[model samples]
Target chain A: MSTSTSTSLTAPTASRVAGTAVLLGLTLAPFLLGPYAVATLSRILVFALLALSVNLLTGLTGLPTLGQSAYFGVGAYTAAVVAKNLTDIGPLQLLIAAGVSALVAVPTGWLAVRARGVVFLMLTLAIGEIVYSAAVNWKPVTGGTDGISGVPPVVPLPGTPALELDGLVYFYVLAVFLLLLGAVTRLGSTPFVLALRGIRDNEPRMKAIGYPTRRYALTVYCGAAALAGAAGSLWVSVQRFVSPGDAGFEIAALALLAVVIGGTGSMWGACAAAALIWLTRDYLGNLEAVAGRGPLLLGLLFVIAVYTLPRGLAGVRLPHQPSRKRTA
Target chain B: MAGWLDGNLVSVVDGIAFGLLLFTIAVGLSLVFGMMDVLNLAHGTLYLAGAYTAYALSDGTVPGLLLALAAGALVGALGGAALTLLTQPLARRGHLDQAVLTLGITFIVADLLAAAFGGEVLPTDPPASLRGTVDLLGHTYPVYRLVFIAVAAALALLVHLVFERSSLGALVRATVADRDMVRAQGVDIRKVLYGVFAFGAALAAVGGVLGAPILGPGPGVDESVLVLSLVVVVVGGLGSVRGALAGALLIGQVQTLGVALLPQYAPFLLFGTMLLVLVVRPHGLVPSAVRT
Candidate 1:
């Protein structure tokens, strides 16, 4: 999955410095941008997390899925339920949401992971649809198509004051986003991830090496579901409303599209692509002339991205990563 | 049990008709996927297009219905050809890329269709001669549905014979088994690929035309039909005619009866049935002998 084509002999120190600069810029972006842009950035961060979740299974484990949004919706609904009925503590809500989503993923993911390729894809798609249908039909529990609203403002911690302003909420989202981003980065370098990469590249070979590939896939599936659930919790926090649409196929498709456009295994690229896609949908679609044409534009973007960015945005060579030989 | 059967008799008949429609659509999908290893997510779009064609052309007459069917098949074939051209380049890239490309096509076509037909469900009427209800065992049933069932069953038999019993079927199966070997034997594999894709897509479109009176054409119809056909393909087994038939009929019953019996959980029944089937037989109810 980590098809790093660059074999450059550049100074590592320079790349480290550039990474620090980029992080610094992101940390200061909310303050520098307008309130509208800051809100959009927060949305981008939530979707970026979802895209990262998709990347874990799709990019890392080679299990293409269309069902992450089910977990996302589950997480969002759980958070909304907690906020309305139990507590407004953001951290607690996020934790419970992620935990529940992971739990739900177990049975579904087990069924899904048993198959490979298109069969797996079909199972996940069915799973997503079922979840969506449940959300719509289970009116007493899920509030039907209307969904749950009137979610209170999120408190970052147990004792901290609630985040009332958009700017403050953006900071709260960023904090959790960075913490999870760090966890995922650490995960990328783990032996488990290495095994997943092995499975992705050649499952039969990995099996011959005595690797329990299905177990790895299931574990990653649950982990990715947890990540998506956390993102869903944040989405509820940001929107203060959870609807069936939150868990619909469009959300799943867009998140996966973000992963594909960003480059499957590249985490940073996913975030960037998520931001670009969000902007295109949120900002460009609202333009006077193009109003209500968001889907059409998104469809065009998908076609163009697949044809032009076959290797994805992250696959582009950076200053330090000079290309040697390209893998066919 | 007799009382229950009497109560649910119409639903059972409806289920068979619905299943036959699904078979018409899904059989093509099973064949194309088995042979080409291409997962055309846009298969439902062809169905939508055919439904729209019926909506536009049918004037409640037998001749008009025939015209709609012909037009629907033609449109489906053209669409299949177009998709083949779009997907051929990605043959080496694997199913994920193919899924993405076809999904994109689906989105674009669905949008265009929405624009042309509006976003409402457009229901077509059966021909005047077929609009009346007829006596079934003890109750009356729609003549159109009964006719549709007969037509669809004939179609199923024709497809089964063509794919399972004919020399062309042998050639197609041979191509699927080993394209290189078939090419070495002086058969044009590309033509076969294109033909299979076109025929499969055309069949789906024809089903759509016939099914429009029952399911109707709406904004999200393509998505729903696509999911159902995917379910049919999975439960019936991937690439075989018998599998599609078995899967479609089973699902059709589940769908119609599940709704009648437990309206609240009908949606779950579709996926639940799929889950059970996969758990029991992962390859499907009737898996194709040749594995991809």
Candidate 2:
């Protein structure tokens, strides 16, 4: 739990410049990228959102989780059901999905917050596996692994036309991704997040200082679950389908890996690592040589990443960390 | 209620067999964690490897099963030793790194196993002698399951004796309690670490070899086994053999009997059970005395 060192809020101007530059590139990507690339980027954006949610807990809040995908799956299924029966409005689906996911997180998060370290990870994993089971066995609602399909195209607004084109959907995803990114960035600086970092750093000390660490852990857990749910909604909007696999262990694992590989406590790092991982899993995995060896290659990436990128891919500290020959 | 109880007596018996199987796998996981503070996520891969050994070596004979068990144990020990070597570097990196690193190993091994054995769950049958049915309290039961229960119970007793009553177990527990203290006594603490890890891994693999017929070995089976063992260890209190048995049996009942009674809520039953345990006994029903 105290594995990663803390990342301070430095390089504010450089980071802002990089953020704007990345946003500009993303805004112009639909024109430069092919439909498939655009669609993949959309998926990456959504996954990045999920990874950010994971980072909220692991990187910022100090609780490592392998269960965020449970919330993601809940959101995806909720959005699918809402789109199929209620409305095709993208924002509404996102809202309802996030809300339902947080609601589902209440009891689950409460139980999860009762423990820390490996115990917490184990609890969350059980929560995820149980939800995955529900998706597979609850045939009436979850459609029993075949999953809910035939989702209507996501409408961005009340009167706006549905987003059918990959580029259009990509834009919508990017917009939401950027919005959440800003929110999380703002959240990182808040006193509440400082308290969370304190809890992560030393929970006993925080408790000694009169902080309700358990309540904070639970609150952040629900918030992260809600964020994961929103990402799932974006996923539904992008794919126009929902499946049990969306909420499976792989999704949760990948999100956790993204946070870890991106440099814990760094939102930008999480997004970059999420993008890289998705690209690896989706793009490289489907190659002819390793056509169905997606898991194998991803596994290799995990091993290699763990060894070679110990500080993570986005672990750039221009002013603080100098290059080193050995671990100090 | 009487009708349900009478009808599900078979389920209760079956739960015993299943729980015993889990204990065989989970006890190793529990002790390794209890002693080493290392959470090897690839622990389930040992079970899968053993199952595949059963699938590969089964010749409808007792010798074949014994051979498979021996081979599986060797494979598991080698796997554990190798894991110890790989994970040793990350010892100071904290458990998150250890967990993620071992998880990487799990993914790699699971993928490799899936590649070699194909994607489908491989069904392994018991030896000719253990095959077929037997009458148990007016209910027809598989002979192999009854045999499994007996063997697994003996295995559990052996484990309990070795870990709780034996001098080696005392050393392992002492190491867990205070590594510096154990090393100060001139004991090669790393040897104990490797020994415990390899022994636990071997036990898990042996369970796989034995439980192949019950749980089967497949692509995702490794993950499922890992999760189940994790739950068992958590419920039984981490690193405690007694706790693993208690938790495994309870879960086995919930899995088998609960499913038989309410298929719709079987999965939730597992979660709800865990939730209740966490709420009522956060350290588990039987927590390890020298906590990590």
Candidate 3:
């Protein structure tokens, strides 16, 4: 607790001013940029949430699940269905999506928590693939590969008018992104988060000390799944559609890769990395000169990150800033 | 009765053939992971390399096919050696490091392969000798498939004898049991790792070469093969040949038969089976005696 207080003080004392400046710059970016850029930023923010969820599990809990897309797809589909049938209230839809995703994750996490190491990863992957296949084949409910479309625009906060246009929706997305960002950041600093990190490093010791490791893992998994679900909800709201491909291996893989690139155990790092990855895939990958080489570039990034920046973007020293002191 | 029997039996036969193919590919993965305590995510890259080599070398003749297989295996050995060397720095760091490095290698090799051979799925045809089919239980089956099954089974038997019966096998087993003990006894642990890694890679490439006609050479084939191999290794228990065989056969039947019987649910069925297996037997159906 004292360390937390000291850490908070030190963080602000050193980087608080710079951090707030960056936040202000990001918030005001859309006002200066075009509608196209705003749309891309919104998409990046959604993926950043997804990457943070993956970080919560893989980085903090030491559960390198390759199946976060299951929750993501579930959330998207839930949001789509709700928008289609029940309500277009963005906040309500996000809540329902997260709730449903967490509920579904309970049993899946139970099954997954039984195994550790690579077995855990494989099981999660299998579960994810199963969900993806279901979405693809359950044509009556899911509409198969065609996916569900024409989702209603999400209602802004306080029952304000719906965000009908892309530019208007960006503000809505930005608001939710900031809220979720705060929530996950707080979660990362909690006792549960500390315990999860301990479990990742020394599960046996934690268990020997009488901690219910499996229960802890399941709890973290559910929390991460809920966050992913929230991301999925935002995705459906933004794209105005839902598809089985939302639950595809690529999303799950990219989420984990984002966490890896961001520096595991750092929520902000994951968010930053997710934005970078999405920008690369959406903007850089689409460049005429670099067309069709997105995967090649991604692969090169993976190689370079593994070798050079083992701790990822978070750990990289800023050009002018002094290096942070190492902790014991 | 005859029509029904043929309809059902044909798929059963097909299932067995496909399962055998999977067994050939997955057994090496199980062995390497089980014995070495390393997870080579790049295992499928070796398979892809083999398929590509076949695409590059073969003149579409039986001799060419044989030459392609040999070259594929040779390339696999070289790739394996390279992986061993590349991963040597992280050897002391443990499985996490190995996984990270191999995953990196998977992306690199996959990209390189895509760059070299356009992203298209390069279809590989069987040799002229296997171009035709023969009647089997009232249904015609590809002759190449039967040949593939025979060749794979023969190789499996050879592998069985070498690992299960020979002195080299005992030494390998001993190495798996206790690396420190093996090294203390003057057996080079590094050499054992290199040999096993090479052998495992060669086995995967062999499967790729033989399986290319059926699986086809493609951009994502490497990842798919890797996932299937992971499933097999997990199902069989890591490092256990018998477990890999059993898991492969089971998955093979599920894949081929599921496709024939319930095409819509086929993909889900494979993963569902894996989930069921993991729940029932977390250590897999047949766990390794020397658990890492």
Best by DockQ: 3
Interface RMSD of each: 4.0, 4.7, 5.0
Runs with alpha carbons beyond 4 Å of true place in candidate 2: A1-21, A137-141, A316-328, B1-6, B287-292
Query: In candidate 3, which residue pairs get closer than 3 Å at backbone N, Cα or C atoms, i.e. clash?
Result: B34-B239
CAPRI accuracy category, model 3: acceptable
- Candidate 3, residues A164-218, lDDT tens digits: the string is 8777888888899899888877775678888887788888899999899999999
Task: Looking at model 2 chain A, report the run of 10 residues with the lowest lDDT sum.
Answer: A319-328
Stretches of candidate 1 exceeding 4 Å from the true structure: A1-25, A32-34, A318-328, B288-292
- Compute DockQ for each candidate against the true complex: 0.41, 0.41, 0.44
DockQ of 3: 0.44
What is the C-alpha lDDT profile of model 1 across A84-190, one tens digit per residue? 99999999999999999999999999989998876677688778888998899988878999999899999999899999888899989999999999999898778
lDDT tens digits by residue: candidate 3, B104-188: 6787778778888988999998888788999886678899989988898898888888888999988888887888899999987
Steric clash pairs (candidate 1):
none
Candidate 2: give the clashing pairs.
none
